[model samples]
Target: MEMESDFYEAALFHIDRERKLYSSMPSRHYHNGYEIFYLVSGDTCYFVDDKAYQVVGGVLMIINMNEIHKLVNSSGETFERITLEFKSEFIEGIFPDNSSIDIFSSFTKGLPMIKLSGQEQGAIEKRFDTMIHEYTQQPPGYESYLKMLLFELLLFIYRKMESNPRPALNEANLVHKKIFEIVDYLNRHYDEQHTIGQISKNFYISPSYFCKTFRENTGFTFTEYLNNVRIKEARNLLTHGTDKISTIAESVGFESLTHFGRIFKEITGMSPLKYRQNYKV
Candidate 1:
């Protein structure tokens, strides 16, 4: 659960580490790249963009770039996971030059988690192990083999997506979509100060109406939502790098380091420095 540093490309990755127990050494945060975690051991509860998913062995969780998320294993138990990270552009390198991006695009977007059967998980695990071996050894022309293995992995994911599709549509789902859209926008633009009035004007609603609806939908008032947003960003920076705490405070829309530290502790139950110490990659 520490801050792990990795540079991922378009290729597949194979991980088979064993954890003795469920340790919440690090809390929630975000990454700069896309990820696919194929759980090979115990169950883990994960938060991806604030939506929680209970993933067990034989389950696969897909995460997009810059997405906020984290993991916690409920039981006092150990587990293993195969985590693969890559860029979306890495897709063009896997697929043929003329192949359409349609199939691949969907994989990165909708319904980001899936649970696989025992047999299905075993098959993918075997291939992933073989792919990892070849990638690490790098025999002559191994790139060709590596690329082929990655293509097979993609094909498997696409087929699984086809088998168990998400529900069609509902009014509740529409409101959920709207809420997530606004949240995503705020996450991307938290540096600029914006009031309920501004957001309501943009969303074509009255200020009071917008505040009430947003709070009802997201379970947090506008100011609370904004504070949490900044706190999440601040934690990411503190644990991920050596930037000055003050600089991170301002980067996350906090006007002062003291306020950032106070709120961070209120949410994370620890100060920024302590959080950083627990997550040195």
Candidate 2:
């Protein structure tokens, strides 16, 4: 099924649990809402943004909105799983509102791709079973019950896998909040001009200081990080069979063909022609 925005607000959700029932083909695309999938049975290759996961029973995946990724099973096998989708605002509403907030952090940003341990998996699944019951049965007041159940399940996962029992508001951490803001903005608008001076200027900081701290925090210089984003977009378009390497380069915001070609070759260690040629095989 083609997943869409707000598949989570009262959520036009779906679950599948049968041989060849819920498996789908690979198409590298990004969504506009959060999604969680539990591989309840069988094993298959699950592709996320720029990586692959050997997903089997009890593994959970959180596919956040706007994260360029895809699902694939090159082995021509079937897998069983249930997928949950929700809106960002809905999840954000779960945060506490405090006026004294200072920093700029978001649970939505820098989310490390996650996997559940064997014990943790079983524990979360037990709660998921309850979620399935509430959702399927849809008894009286089931709406609130369903939301409440989902909330608890999420909290349970976070508690088990995350160091924090509950994530505080972004304002809780000043430096991280600022960095996250910059990263979020960059991700959303990397196709535009995003010099360190421009970003630092908007944030009311000196360019030199911003560059130094950003490198320290994210472990990459500003240019390197921007190219990383561009390259990821390029890979997505290429994997999805978009034609014209020149078009992909422009779409990803490189201003010049020569510069784009050089950067692509530098990072990927081959020309775009070579890159796309391999995918044709």
Candidate 3:
């Protein structure tokens, strides 16, 4: 079963409990809202940013806006999960005088995934169940009620994390470890020029092997991932700084303004100037 709701474009809730296998790999993607992913059953490998986490039943992944991530079946079995995504403004003034606690700090600064104890999982899953019921029923004032439920869920996780911080369950295979290191390198050095042959030589892996392994682990070809990283940073610069479009293009690793404009439009659906005009704060 699956259920989804879009609350006036401010938030979304989705629940899936099907027993199925992935016929094709899902693409790596990012978005402009925070995401909460709760694994209800089965196991999978979740790639967040550069690290691949071994996500199992009762695991929760808190992803900040614009973080690159994807999920792959690790056990070749069925899985179920619930996803909630919301913009920061959705809960901006929902809590009165709650100035000290930033409920979303964990998404931005803390661990990416948390393994909950049996009891904690039951309690958190109960909240998710209630939200599902409320959304399905849509009784009077249910929208407001759903917002309250969302707040309660976030608060529960916040408190639990404050009390018992757990480390992420990272993938341990040697190949995955090396790929993650390369991913981290790419993320940090997206502004620099790179090529598959060059990166393969630097990383001490054969070019063919590097290409195959990178796509298998990250769901993106080497060039695709590099372009994504550069474009993500370009978006940040466009939205936050008053830099010339050509300068921004060169700064984010594009050799020419024409190439940068084309790729930026391909990824973001708009030219750099238009994006900056629309999204600049």
Candidate 4:
């Protein structure tokens, strides 16, 4: 079962309960607003930027805007989750002017995953239930009520994090640890030229095994992952810098302008020039 609500483009809420295993993970992507993901049951692997987390039931993952992430099932168990996404404007004026707190700071600082205790999880579940009810029923002032509920939820999490910080989740296997290290390396050096064989040699693993493990853990082949990292950086440059398209292409590790244009369009659904025109500030 799945339920979803979109509030005037500023916020979105979704709940999904799946009884069967997912044949494939969702495509890697990022959002324009902050994302709050609560795993209600089962287990999964969550990749956020450079690190991969072994997320289980009762874990909440916060992803900042434009941070690349993906979730893959870790086992054949059924799973359920609730996701809330909201732009900054969605909760504007909720905070007092003199307050020193930034409720959403968790999205930017510290570990992205939070492990909630049984009691804490119950509290959060109640807030989600209320938000869902208000959204579905559309009672008087339901929109405002929903916003308040979201604010309360975030504040509760923020306070919990402040009072008792949890350690980061460890990789479940040695192979996963090594693959995540490779992911970190790739994230930092995406603009440099690389080859699977070279990376495997540097990381002290057989090329074939590296390819298999990388794909299994990250849901992307070596080449695909490299291209994604490079393209992700390329997108940032296109949006924030005044570099020429060819320069941007080469800087992000594409050897050929034509190839860059082709891949850029393939991944982003538009030519680089068009993307720049639409998104450049």
Q: Indicate which candidate wins on lDDT.
A: 3
TM-score of each: 0.50, 0.46, 0.55, 0.54
Candidate 1 lDDT, 172-272, residue by residue in tens: 22243344456556756777787887887777777777776665444356776676656655665887778888888888888878988888777666788
Q: How badly does each model clash, as a count of residue pairs?
A: 0, 2, 0, 0
Candidate 4: what lDDT?
A: 0.71
lDDT of 4 at 33: 83
TM-score of 3: 0.55
What is the per-residue lDDT of model 2 for residues 36-118, given as tens digits with 9 covering 90 to 100? 77765444445555555444344566766666555554334455567776663543444466324311222254442344443
Clashes of 1: 0
Q: How close is candidate 2 to the true structure, as a TM-score?
A: 0.46
Off by over 4 Å in 4: 1-20, 23-25, 165-281
Which candidate order results from sorting by lDDT in descending order?
3, 4, 1, 2
Candidate 1 overall lDDT versus native: 0.63
- Winner of 1 and 4 under lDDT: 4
* Winner on TM-score (2 vs 3): 3
